[model samples]
Target: IPTIKLNNGREMPVEGYGCWKINYDRVWSLGSWLFNDDNRAGQVVLQAIRAGYRYIDSAYFYNVEKGVGHALRYAFRTGIVKREDMFIATKIWNNFHRRDRVVEGIRRSLRDMGLDYVDLAIIHWPMGFEDGDDVFPMYWNLSNVPREWSRNGFVETWQGMTDALDMGLAKSIGVSNFNIKQLKVLMDSSKIKPVVNQVECNPYYNQNKMLEFCQQNNIVMTAYSPLRQGYDLLDDPNLRRIARRHNKTAAQVALRWNIQRGVAVIPKSERRRRMNENINVFDFELRDDEMKAIDLLRQMPKLLTFGTTRSHPDYPFHDSY
Candidate 1:
């Protein structure tokens, strides 16, 4: 696997396994068990590592770090891989943005993942929610904003993240779902700059301007939903045509496009075969025309807008990136 050199001098894998929506409770369902062939997040993560993925992306919101940690321990015991080589990353949830709560948030995630330190710790989103035990505090519906918002600004939350770095809880810290303006505010106020900005980037929502901005600032841009989470991009005729030319799946082509653009992708999948396919794009390179053809998809609507939080003060999608 290829690695991207982060601003903090850390090397991160360009392709990674995303553990987002792999709910621990849902793994017991018949569909999950049948397709995944493993009922635990650890099993799935183990399968991913076996499939040649070196980067594993997880988060507090995913609620499966314990299972993921179980897999990591098993892998280590069996000599499948070493902890230092595997780039493990997690996020600080919105509810833990206060300077005082920041250290506690990462500590909880570390305890859940059974790790002394994470390769990367990211601010999950720019917005800060009511600080409490609830993940989505006062969130009763998806279509409306939450009832309460945290008074803690992202800068304050970043101060807590810096503390985590100072205390050796996280190797490097970055942000997710932040826009240009938000990035500037944090960059201006803090001495340590963000190494990367993770967001929902795919063919439909290309994030061209944001990519340019991050590149100019020497910040790597990571794509979380690189495959759009479903068949929408895979089924497109243009993408399929390019895939056929390269003898790769549309999913591979989609991922390669992001990789060619210098963006790291964390595509999630429960099946082992798909995991293999996702990490097998290093051999083939998309031609210039092929990349431009995929670029035509920039107009497609965003799949994960997080629009319900549009009214929140820290909502990132409100700006035109």
Candidate 2:
């Protein structure tokens, strides 16, 4: 796996296994945790690690940290990888944006994962939801009604992230789903700049300007949905042409496109075959024209807008970036 040097001089794996949408079955109706001993999620994580994945991207919102933790423990005990050998990155959820909750959030994730510290602990989203146990506090018990937003700004949350760093809870800190404008505000107000800005990026919704901005600011750009979940980016003619030329899958072409642009990617897959394919992009390279051909797909509509939170004051996608 290629590595990207963070602003803090930490080297992060260019490609990682994302843990989003894992163990959703445990999240009964999105209301509570079942707390069963089903380690299916951990087994998949272990499989990913066994397939040469070193970076594991997770978050409190994922609700599978315990399973992921079990896999990490099994790997460590069985000599698959040491704690320092893997780069584990989790996020502070929106409800945990308060300064105090920021520290608590990471601690919770650490506790769930059975780790003392994480390589990277990022703000999951710039917008904060109402602080409470519920990830999404509903309004008037109506699921479709507008969710409550927190008054606390991310600047305050970043301060807590800095606290997490000061206390050695995380090796590096970052923000996710933040636009260039929001990043500027946070950078201006905070003492330590975020090392990364993770967002949805792929051939379809290529974040060209955002990537340039983050690169200019010395921040690493990471793509969460690098493959555009549920959408077949592999069906695109340009990507298929490039994939055939290299005898690679279109998914490989998409991931390679991001890697070639110096953007780190965290593509998720429950199946081991797809997991192996996602990380097998190191052998081939994309030419300039091929990269441009993939870039043309940026005209397509973005896959994830998180439009439910659009009314929030700090919603990021409202900006052009």
Candidate 3:
């Protein structure tokens, strides 16, 4: 697989395996610990590594970092993947939004993942919750918002992330769910530019303008939620036709469309065949007409609407990207 070199000199795989709900049958809320065991998710992480996936995208908010860490070590012990060969990425959650706690959040993620460094660490979102014992403080109470509810707070958090990079905690630092304006603010105030801006992108909503902006700035725009609950992306008539032309599944066509345009995508699954299918996109290329057809798919953008924290002042989607 070819690698895209970030401004910071980090090489990220163009296609990665998303680990949002890897082991579990379905995604549960932050309150899921009361009813289920998350420890089982780690085995699936090991499974992906054994299946030849070199990049794994996860987040502390998913409650699966510890499991992911276990998988990494197991993969190493079994000689499935080396520590240096895999690109591991995780995010800092909104609960630890304070500048003082931003580095601390990455620290927690490293400890949970059982790694000294992450290939890339990102600020999960622009919003910071009221500092408290609750992980999802905003979800628990809508009034729980940070005192600095503007770009200033985001800048402060970005500084802390910069410090993490300097201290060797992460090789690269970036943001998730940030709009064009927020990205500009950070790039202006910080010494290091964000390498990528990950968002909910797929054939349904290709984010043409945002992709152009990131490309112009030399930042990679990563797509998540490429296929959601209904697998509707797998059933789209256009995607189906494209898949038939390539002898690939609709899912592979959707993923390849993003990859062909230089947008990295992380599609998640636990099944071995499904896992390998997500990364088998380098075999074919999408023509200009097919790319245009996929780009013009009716825009029902943003499948992952974080409704619980929608009221926060730093909410990213208020202005369209």
Clashes of each: 0, 0, 0
Model 2: C-alpha RMSD to truth?
A: 2.1
Every candidate's lDDT: 0.86, 0.88, 0.82
lDDT of 3 by residue, 213-257 (tens): 999999999988876444566778998898899999888888888
Candidate 2 lDDT over residue span 1-321, tens digit each: 879999999999999999987676765344566665549889989999999999999998888899999999999999999999999999998888879999999999999999999999999998887777788655553332222344338888899999999999999999999988888999999779999999999988898999999999999999988999848777888888889999999999999999999999999999889999999999999999998888877466777776667777788877779
Candidate 2 clashing pairs, residues 3+ apart or interchain: none
Among all windows of 10 consecutive residues in model 3, the one with the lowest summed lDDT is: 26-35
Name the regions of candidate 2 deviating beyond 4 angstroms: 27-30, 33-38, 141-152
Top-scoring candidate (TM-score): 2
Candidate 3 deviant stretches above 4 angstroms: 23-32, 139-144, 228-231
C-alpha positional error of residue 123 in candidate 1 after TM-score superposition, expressed in Å: 0.5
In candidate 2 the C-alpha lDDT for residue 206 amounts to 90
Flag regions of model 1 displaced more than 4 Å. 24-39, 139-152
> In what order do the candidates fall by lDDT, top score first?
2, 1, 3
Q: Report the Cα lDDT for candidate 3.
A: 0.82
